[model samples]
Target: MSKATKTIHAAMAAHVSSALDALQAAGTLPEGIERGNVTVEPTRDPAHGDLATNAAMVLAKPAKTNPRALAESLAEELRKVDAIDSVEIAGPGFINLRLSDNAWRDELRAIAALGETYGRSTVGEGTRVNVEYVSANPTGPMHMGHCRGAVVGDALAGLLEFAGHDVTREYYVNDAGSQVDTLARSAHLRYREAHGQDIGDIPEGYYPGEYLKPVGEAARERFGDTYLEATESEWLPVFRGFAVERMIELIKADLALLGIEHDLFASEAELQAAGKPEAAEAWLREHDLVYDGELEAPKGKTLDDWEPVELPLFRATRFGDDQDRPIRKSDGSWTYFGADLAYHFQKAENADALIDIWGADHSGTVKRIKAAVAALTEGSGRNVPFDVKLVQMVQLLRDGEPVKMSKRSGQFVTLADVVREVGKDVVRFTMLTRKPDAQMEFDFAKVVEASKDNPVFYVQYAHARIASTLRKATAAGVAPSADGLDRLGEEELALVKVAAQFPRIVESAAAAREPHRIAFYLQDLAAAFHAFWNLGNDRPEMRILVEDDAEITSARLFLAERIGQVVRNGLAILGVEAVDEL
Candidate 1:
């Protein structure tokens, strides 16, 4: 555990136990109130004070006392604790506690001691977690829509690892799908063009992008027109395999452009190797989750091509889904959901927890997937749980005008294009500035702006500022070491206290599977550091490296160096760049 986390936990345990004792003494509580429910979190509104608790409101009904009365009594008890500078009962029986300045100052010293490891935690306790994301079909280049899931999943994995979870980043390859067949046909058209044949307007259903020309040329070089005159059935598999392999290579390159590397690349084709869909079918049958049924046409919209058909279906409604879903088509081919269910089952066998990051358009699929897992793990009694995080769309804009993108026209913005335009650091940091479930707008102009509005720049600037302070200290023949961190002033001390909260932030972000929390925390930390820096301009003593006092300069430099280390560490977790000299 990081030093910041240890201090926060100790502070919480001490304060909570004291409050329970006071409640017991006043006889205003039940025989045993679950103190485990009490929590200390930094309040969103800083005016409410440092940390606030809703413990009084939560315990009031159980104690049969007015919430305000309970809060008042709790406040009186908290005031006696040396760690608490003051305690106040706010609206609706909330207890807000302000810690003494020394508490904040001491946190700075702890941050200096811990350095880059300041915000890390052991909350996950080495639980194996698999995060599967960006499983885009290998038909063509990845469009802008695929960017959010890739960034969120990667960031979430980083957050989990920092919080001490054994996390595996995975990418599921959809090479067995019909999309790859379409890609083969598309490549065939390109091959015809390479052979000087008039391929015409890119046959109706095939891809029309010029990106496939290389694949075609490579196919021609390897096959030497041998398969050119062959039937579709004889040559389709050959072309499909070649095209999918090349597409995967292209996808890997795109991912590398954005600094993402998956620990596992699971293939859908592997699930049904050698003409056997047994893995998925057997798992579904073992749980009695599969049955023959007819699916109703989708509601709210009527499809002219809709036809009622009976087939093998997963009894998803038995759990919590709205209706049963098909696992096999009438033609005996496995449905998309069937392959996914089996893939998740295979994933469950390898990891303690499963997390799939998907696009928002797949929201309707969440319930059935969870239902399948619950059914599969019914009697064996192992906790084989799964979580699906849906990342909402990112609308790209340039100067407030929406950037046009159309996949059909092959005119959509590619992930590689965005990364090249804004650079990986800006792309990643901006992508995570908003919560996963919230729709985000990526403004190209604002992302590159060198102002506070650009969180990436602001955070980087804070790190750079701290580095400058250290450089100034070193030039004056003073070495800032952990031993001298005790001499930090109020402003320096406040920055340190904020830095000490990193481990707690990591723990919270990992537990919630919300990496945006880390981004938000970093921005706030930067704001605090910037505020302190501005204060230094007004008060010479507040400057991190004071010229007159060697001891004071060394202490301030120690705190500043720690701040820079923490900024780098936090940025690293978000897969963002921390510029030492912005």
Candidate 2:
């Protein structure tokens, strides 16, 4: 936790303890009031006071005393505390405490002492967490929609790790599906082209991207004309394996372009290898969650050949699914849901928490997956917690014009394309400027603009401005050490106080799985720093690196340096660059 949070907690505890003592002495309360229920939080309205508590209002009825009387009594008791400068009883007997400037000034010292480690926490207690994200089908390159999930998942994992979780970043490879078969066909066409064959038009229902030409050529080089004479059974597996491997390699390169690295690459095919599907089916059967049934037709999509046919189905409805879902097709091949169940079962054995970062398209699949987990665990779901975060789509634009993306035409803008165009730092920061559930608009032109309107540039500028101040301080012979911080002015003290809140911000954002909160907090911090910087222009005495006074200059420099460190640390967690001289 940050120094501000610690101070808040400590001060609030003392105040509450004193109030309890007063109540006990007056014999106006029950034997044991839960002091833990009392909380101290920054008042939403700054005019109200620095900190506000509803403790008296909460304890009034139970203590058989009027809330105002109790608040007055608590106020009298809290006035004895050293940290609080004054106390007032507000509306409904709410207690508002105004703290001494020193209490706020001490935050700067705490921030300087902790440095970059100021915001780090141990709340997660080392629980193992598996974060699976961007499990995009390896059929083609990643697009704008994929960027949001990648950034959110990566930031969340970083946040959790900072909060003391044993996080494992994973990518689930969907290699066993029919989409890969299309990829193989596409690669086969490319292979024919590579072999000097006029494989004119990309076949219908096959991938048509020019990217596969190289994979096709590689395949031809590995197996020349051999697959031409082979039967479908003999060549499909070979071609599928080759295509899948090449696609995975390309996907990895694309992810690297965005600075994403996965510790685990789980394969759906591997889950079904050596008759694992049958084993999974058997396990379900033993648990009585599987049976032969006919599924209802989907509500929206039309199925012309739909017929009532008995097939293997999971009793998903029993565990909260909307209806029983098919586990096997009419041809007896495992359905996608069946494969997914087996995959999740495998995951349950390895992780204490399963966090799947999926695009909004898969929102409907969430409930059934949860139901399957419940079925697989047979009511012992405590060992595995499933959290599915649906990342909304990103609408890309340039100069107010939509960047049309069509997957069928193989002309969709890829993640690598965006990174190359705008740089990874810009891409990562812009992707997180909004909440994950909200649709985001990524305007190529606006993101690169070096203005306050662009959040990335704004935050980076704050850090750079601090660097400029530090340089100015050193040039002016101001000692950049903590020993001189005792002379810090109110402006410098305010900046320090803001910096001290970073630890608390980190803890709250990590606990909420809201990395966007970090971005918001950084923006606020930057705004505070900028406001202070502008004050220097208006009042020379407010400048951080004051000249002709060694002690005051040193104190100001320490505060400026601490602000830069905090900006860098917060940006690092969000995977954004902290340019020292931008």
Candidate 3:
């Protein structure tokens, strides 16, 4: 890495480390205080300082000193650093430090040198993470409920990879469930119709989507009436396999429209065939985590078939769930929870951490799954971190009114429909405009509108405007450089300081597993860039491309280019395109 391209936080952190070393050498502070607790971040109120930290507070207990006292000593050592202009101790021992204008200028130069690689981090340390998302049942196509999870999960995996993780994107197929049985039956009716048999009226419990017609035709062509006289048991498995394969292809094609592809697809049928769920249950039984018990009827809901029966149950209450969960049903078949627990156990075998992105309808399932992970990991004498992120529903809107939706496979607003309506970038960016757990409105009109009200357009416009500046500067034989970077005035320097926070933003956002933070940060950075450009409107001297004063113009262009670089990098992590022109 070029010395000029060191991140601003890295540079400040080095100074902090050295200052701690100096204190340790002088015997003023202990030698082995944990420095991982130390952090350097930009303050929200610029009036307080350029950057702030709670290091003194974090270390005071370890150093056997009050926070304010520790801050005073730390300030004395910090002021010796050349980058710092002044240091002050705020209430409760927050240390705020202002850096010289040269620090921000050097940051701009670093960004210009590093370009797209500027904001990438090494915080993840190459730990393996398995991210499972959009595991929509292979019985149908991906619908509106699946879109948010797909985009969020993909973006999060990208963020973790950019932060130096070994990430595997995976999908778990529920092809072994009763849903697929119903799907196979539905395809059977269609298959008969394809063979010129009079089959009418899709029964109530079977899938009625017209998309299965193609699957039926394919089956008839492949088998040629061989299954026409077969028993129900003989044909059920055959048709189930055929229909599942076709639906998975359709699901994959829909995912491709949004630029999503899973690195692995785990089938529930295969896991069941391999006896994973049975093995997990046997292990839990040996550990006394599983038992034969009868469960109470669910609260606020009536079960008409509430006959009490002994079932294999997991002791979930020990791990903080409100109730012990049943893992096996009366007929000895594993429940959905049982299959899911086994799937997660398989994921935990290869990953140090596991993340599942599910629609909010599964929020209640989270606690039980986490409980199972705890019990299963305890059996292995290894603890793995498992997190389930619930993505809420997206209410589709057109213009100002709500758009009606269908849940049927062929009738729903498929992921492809939205991606086709607006561009993929728009759909992806709009999905992340809100937090994953918050209900959001996917407005077709607003997303495609070319205005500041549309965040995708606003942020993309910033990058495109910078591209225009670069083209103009190139035609006029000008380029960004630090030779006369000191010519930048206070407002320009202030903006550069904000631009330098890109690395910090990335680290914090990735650590929190919230890629939405990147979206919001890019919007803020874009607003700053546009405001800087507007200043040139009222004052001719502040214009970026001053042919007469080439040195000042070079400094301005250098700042603009760096801001553009940050915006581009941020958009890349969110899986959105940083268009050259919007």
Candidate 4:
């Protein structure tokens, strides 16, 4: 109901809504009918029309009429709009519409007028969202294992911000977990190595990455052999705090390589020290969501040491989980679920919605965490939207062979090294070329290849081509002008039709919380532009820059400039730079 700048599709839907309202007021249709199902989208086949709507089909049954009969009435109302050239009722009461030439020209002007902010929408207005992503444990430098989620989270945050949501980008630091203890032990070995001790062959349980050497060196520099001969208890806390801090610094640097920066780094250690988990548990107990219960052993498998023990359990089964989940261990330590539930509770205190981008490896735990959030929020009489997006691991390949270890990190390929080999834009764009949950292979050779098969290169090439055309036109004594846009033909208008879908794409992508939709949309726009550009191969006049006619040349250049703007806007959302020249 709140109006912002309208996309072509939105505008068409609004027209249908208005027509329905008029029909209701005139007693032709029933009043108080739900119109939620009405939708407008681009027609699949070009021969049919430009846009199609299912308003009649969606509202027909509710209006006490058949679909075809309602479609005829709706088509009559739609045909009266000046922008619609013709309306045709298709199979099953779907109505397709072709727009007048002036309508496409108007959209081109809107693109130029809106410039970089063309695709922005206010549909998510007045909502504040918390987006937590790439909370890789603070035990080591980020590798390919963390790269996909990092990019996906950052891109989704950007997409939501573009769609008019107030977004907080956060990274939850797992400093309280056992992994950081392993990190401290690992750094201790390196610290000894730094102090002229031959600490050979990092032991099996400790981190082996050479990246921790710097942390050890820094520890030695700060403590100056103070803890070299101390007891584990005396030095454990000191080294644990020191190593976690240093690892966070390293993590920040690695994230920077991919153009990601978090607004907050919520620490699990600090959260525990603040007694948030205890508070959450107390609250859950008060609401009867938590109870002391005995749980069965692992399903489908048995351990000789396994025994039923009473623990504080969350009744997650009541909220669609497979079974009740334990919040505490026999030793009275909080489980990962306990700490994560408290963390999400903390996040929900200040945001209207919560989204976490996690690696698919954590897929099993998603249900329990979601159930906890739902229990805490809904039980407190507040409704907070929550979503968990799982990003699959990226299989790094070089020339069709699996890429193994990074000599720098000593375990897996570091994200920084990959970014160094291929630029940040290439890495970021390539990660998004597939859906987040679908398995994918990141081929260094394939991503850098200068061919249509490479989406990153292909989309960039389209923008570069448009830039080149604009420069050539300027050198040829012509400038982009809207004056001659009316002289454009069907081919040029078709490109505009594709570009005009940007606003709709932004809203839908933001609504779905899928940033890859923007990437996919850009690919389609790039393909359309390239196909139009290829027309110049056979007919010289079909080119963007014609030597003889300055009038049409300026018009075409204007069109190209707008397309480049759209590409830039889309790239900006993905944290990929839109290069004027590749």
* TM-scores of the candidates in the order shown: 0.88, 0.90, 0.96, 0.96
- Per-model root-mean-square deviation over C-alphas: 3.5, 3.3, 1.9, 2.0
Q: Please report how far candidate 3 places residue 67 from its true position, in Å.
A: 2.4
Candidate 2: misplaced stretches above 4 Å? 1-38, 54-81, 274-280, 297-306, 381-383, 483-490
**Per-residue alpha-carbon lDDT of candidate 2 for residues 144-180, written as tens digits (9 for 90 to 100):** 7788999999989988888788999999999888888
Clashes of 3: 0
lDDT-based ranking, best first? 4, 3, 1, 2
- Name the regions of candidate 1 deviating beyond 4 angstroms: 1-5, 9-11, 14-35, 43-49, 52-98, 195-198, 274-279, 297-307, 481-489
Q: How much is 50 displaced in model 1, in angstroms?
A: 3.9
Off by over 4 Å in 4: 1-6, 300-305, 406-409
Ranking by TM-score: 4, 3, 2, 1
Give the alpha carbon lDDT tens digit for every residue of 1-582 in model 1.
443535654565567677778779778677776666777777777677788888898888878889999888888888888768889888989988878766766666666566667777777899999999999999887778999899999999999999899998999998888888899888887877788788777767778787899998988898888887889998899899889888989899999988899998988897668433566566667767787777888776466768878998888889989899888878988888887777777787778899999999999899998988777655346676689999999999999999986666667788898889889999888889988899899988999999998998998899888887777777878887656655555566556667767777787789889999989989998999899888868888777667787887776677677777888888899898788686
lDDT of 1: 0.82
